[model samples]
Target: MQQLLAPIYSFLQCETPDSWIEEAKKPEQLKGLLIDHCNCELKAAQTAMFLVRKYAIDKQSGQLLLDWAKPYENFVYIKNRDIGVFLSKGSKKNELSGELVARKDFAHSDDLIQKMVRLIKEEFHHFEQVLEIMHSRGIEYQNVRAGRYAKGMMKQVRTHEPATLIDKLIVGAFIEARSCERFAKLAPYLDDELKKFYISLLRSEARHYQDYLKLAQAISVTDIGDRVAHFAAVEAQLICSTDQDFKFHSGAPVLNVTA
Candidate 1:
């Protein structure tokens, strides 16, 4: 596990505060945590799809990306949807109608599409996995308002051409890296099933961060170190600062009532 976390540890400015972990591992927190986690997985996939649609692919290809998320979105958006029905459906909508064609205008468009597509697929599967776990635990799925963690970083994105794209990628990297680090930190405190599941997540989560970073670098003409460091500080402040909301990526809890 240390091998997997070494880079993640070095990448972030600070580890998730022990206070956050203390709140996260509680029996009562498990339901909220898993629910928020399932939401995070879906959001991550949506973010990847957004990046592919906006910065990398043609409109047709972008619609292909949107089509892939429709079933999952329908599941979430429909009022009074059954969790069992979604699980039993078994992700038929996950398969894309066809391969994406990158825009000739961009140099790294194909790489972005390729990497983000793979990420979207994995995140969708992770969403289902969490849903299955929630079902098994008798924890019903419910919509939770998003925490400030991602919005905190996203608010800092630059308002320029490539810089905007690059900054978004860096933000994506921090989010993924933090998720990986948090999973490692919290795994030992969880039950064997969840512990194994979180531990199993480390590899892809780590790769997802690296993939974001690599795409950022590939797309940039100059060094991304400064931009990365800027977000590292921002991300750390978000992690280290006291946050009232308890979520999968929330900071220290002020008052924890099942998040």
Candidate 2:
């Protein structure tokens, strides 16, 4: 776990607050934590799909990507909230195999498509895994309003073509890195099954952040160091500051409730 967290610790400017961990470790908060986590995994997959559809793939291939995500989308959006049905539908991996037509202007469009697609797949699987855990524990999934963390970083995105893309990727790196870090931080306090699952996610989440950073650096003509630092600061503030709501990625707990 130290080996997995070494890079993430070095990447972020601050750690998740002790207050937040104390609040999250409560018995009552476990369901909310898991629900928020399930939502986060879905959001991550959706974001990857958005990046690919917008910048990398052609219209046809973009539609295919949308089609690939339909069931999960249905579960979230259409209120087809049956966990068993959703799980039984399973992943549509075979349907996703085809020649994705890359956009003409983007030089590394293929790279973007390949990496984002793989990321989407992994995130969706993680989503299902979380749902299975929730189902087994009889915790129902519900949509929760997003906290300030992601929006705080996204507000800093540059509004140009590749610049926007590059900045978004950097933001992606921070989100993934933080998630990895929090998973490690919270693992020791969780039950054996959840501890193992959170530990299992460390490798892929670490690799996902690295993949985002590499793609951002490769795509940007200018040095991304300043931008990365800027977003890291923003992300750190979001993690360390006081927050009212308690969600997976929320800042320090402000509520007085105890276990």
Candidate 3:
């Protein structure tokens, strides 16, 4: 675990605040923490699915991606939060037809498709795992609003074609890296089962960050170091600053009150 976190610790500008950990270790915060975590997993899968559909696949294939996500989407949007129903629907295999070709100018579209599709699959599986945990604990799943962490970074995304794509990829890398870092930071404060689960997530999350960085570099026409550093700064500030809400990815807690 130390070996896995070493690079992520050096990559980020700050560690999660001790105050936040203190707040998170309380009993009242467990439900909110797990709820946001479950939502986060689905959102991660949805983000990866969107990238693959928009940049890599054809119209029909895009529809298939939507079909693949429909069950989870229904659970989130329609408030159908039953764990049994959600699991029973199951996930579809993410197979693509030969007709699903890359755009004319983007050279690494195929790579993006391959990597992002795999990411989507794993994220969905994580979503199910979190749901199972919640069910076992008798904690009902609820839709929680997103925190500032991702939106703040996304506000910096460039607006043009490949630049837009590249910026989003870089943002993806930061998000994944931050997730891995926080998982490591918070694991020791949690119960044994939850601690093990969070630690188990580190390997795949690390790989996801590396995959995003590699894709961003491969697709960029110029050096991405400056852009990466810029987003890293934005991510760091979001982590270190005071945040009103105490979420899984939120900053230092402003209030001592539990959720």
Every candidate's CA RMSD: 2.3, 2.0, 2.6
lDDT of 1 by residue, 45-131 (tens): 999999999888899888888889998999898888889988998768678998898889998888998899999999999999999
Candidate 3 wrongly placed segments (more than 4 Å): 89-101, 256-259
Off by over 4 Å in 2: 93-97, 257-259
Question: lDDT values of the candidates?
Answer: 0.92, 0.90, 0.86
Model 2 alpha-carbon miss at residue 203, Å: 0.3
Candidate with top TM-score is 1
lDDT of 2: 0.90
Candidate 3, 43-71: lDDT as tens digits: 99999989988888777878878887877
Tens-digit lDDT string for candidate 2 (135-196): 99998889988788887888999998889999999999999999999999999999999999
lDDT of 3 at 254: 94
Q: To one decimal, what is the Cα RMSD in angstroms of model 3 from the true structure? A: 2.6
